[model samples]
Target: MTLADTLKGMIGLDPTAHADADMKAVLAALKELNPKPIEECSVAEAREQPTPADAVRKLMTQAGHAARLPLEVEAVQSEDTVIPGAAGSNPARIYRPAGDGPFPLILYFHGGGWVIADLDVYDATPRSIAAQSNAIVVSAHYRQAPEHKLPAAHEDAFAAWRWIVESAASLGGDPSRIAVMGESAGANLAINVAIHARDSGLRAPLHQALIYPVASNNIVSISYEENRSAKPLNKKMMLWFVQNVINDEGDLKSPLIDVVSADLSNLPPTVVVTAGIDPLRSDGEKLAEKLRDAGVAVEHRNYQGATHEFFGMAPVVQAARDAQTFVSLAQRQAFGGVPLEEAP
Candidate 1:
């Protein structure tokens, strides 16, 4: 039989079956937490549900991979601090490189649909960014929706960005070479922060890495249909998130919320990452296209067989490891714009 025929014979012919085995394994482990469906749960209940980070740790520990990690992974130092915002303050974690002296600074934002998740739930990605790029990463949590509502997270993100720009130097970071990185809803905030920096004449980010951003409002796109029931994130869950964040239809027209329709010119070099099995795949892809059209330098990487939240599952998923490496290399290039050899 042909290769395709043999593969079909072994694992059936369902398109959904094309998902990575490791990704499915993590999803299975996530299901073990018995989370109520997002559309069916209260905001508090949704926040209490098992996060993708939990699933990654669960799968690794269960498979006996936790004990195999290199001890050097602990070299990076992490400390908790508070980022002062207009309304109040948000908790932030700063990760410093092992062998560092004024390293490049990266301000990271966590994805939770602007309704759930936090810095702790997103610990892996920022730590991985620090370990791989040897840069200082400050991952901060913004206010969520239904309680704080729309623009609250965005306001907090800007506050965090401004704080990072003003304080990175004092924190042993090279403020001249700063970057922004985020996943899902947080990606939405990262790009907007870069824009706000340009408008405010603040120190602009040198680069931005957005993973599976919520760029376009077109939730009926192909990925939504293809992965309508995707685990961790889906069309139904997105609708739930939207309702919680937006007070009304007018909120949808805000340039901060309507990212795809906003001006994207003169932004920093960007890296947009998309997962093949994710509902936000088209969102990232479309954002990348918009950046290119606006004369911005952009690189888009679509990880086939990977799902949303896979970027933080490096310990249990190969694709996650590869994605981490890709982002780290991209961030390093933006930091120095130097080639691999003949330099420090």
Candidate 2:
């Protein structure tokens, strides 16, 4: 049996019947790439591991699809730039759909557990969001772990938020109508950005789209126990990420890291997304619960048969399309703009 099948079999989960067919294909492709486990690799080795996005691209290319999915997913204007960070400067990418007037801005973050992956690895989601949500999307990259551990990324997130807020207008976006977005660990950064803004009396994000966020330091929750062997993102991988980023056991309790234990009061309206076959599913669900309990407006959507990092694979996954629409509609309403029509 293949490594993917062997792993799934060992966990008593049937890949073919457990996840969506399309999602299964992507997972299989990723497994076929045969990267070392995050727990078993050096930081450099981990960074080089084939990602879910790569799997999506490979499938698209092999299927005789059009180009590498920036425009294939949705047509939007894109540019690369640099932004100031808590440490040295970091890189950023901006996505704008066809338009004349300034559009609503979304300061975004890509997920790699604060270690691997960069702006290029996460191009699909922001590009799609720009068109469907009628907003300009600015995706940011921060310092990574094993080199720049916890709070390094957090500080950079705040710096990126500060930069985006001031420069939105210059980029053909409305500074007054702004939001924040991210996937997985990046979502953790996004919410912390909002909390930082509220505490510092800075401009607030109208909404936050948190896709499969790393909400808590709790890695042994029910969902974690269940999807501990799920592909692309299992409990072991999540633990590896935490281990690399934190300096000590105490770091796990920091509000910035254990966001579920942080203050959720007065944060923006939130969209918490969860994948049925993900270790962080509990993270997303728990954060949503805490947000609502803290009196923030919450819209939580859990897609069964989907996996972590599926948010950006809409070009190959139907759940992704539905999620894109769900997030777009939510953001449109929050920005007080006209309703966003379905993506063409």
User: lDDT of each prediction vs. the true structure?
Assistant: 0.86, 0.88
TM-score of 2: 0.92
TM-score for each candidate, following the candidate numbering: 0.92, 0.92
**Lowest-sum lDDT 10-residue window in model 2:** 64-73
**lDDT string, candidate 1, 1-344, tens digits:** 86545533533223346778887888888889777898899998998888878877777777454634434446778999898875898899999878848899999999989999988999988988897888999998989999999889998999999999999889998879899999999999999999999998988999999999988778767677677777777778998999999989888888777798998999999999999888899889888999999999888999889988999888888888888878888889888845423334
Q: How much does each candidate deviate from the true structure in C-alpha RMSD?
A: 4.6, 4.3
Measured with C-alpha atoms, the lDDT of residue 272 in candidate 1 is 90
Give the Cα-based TM-score of candidate 1 against the true structure. Answer: 0.92
Query: Pick by lDDT: which candidate is best?
Result: 2
**Model 1 misses residue 270 by how many Å?**
0.2
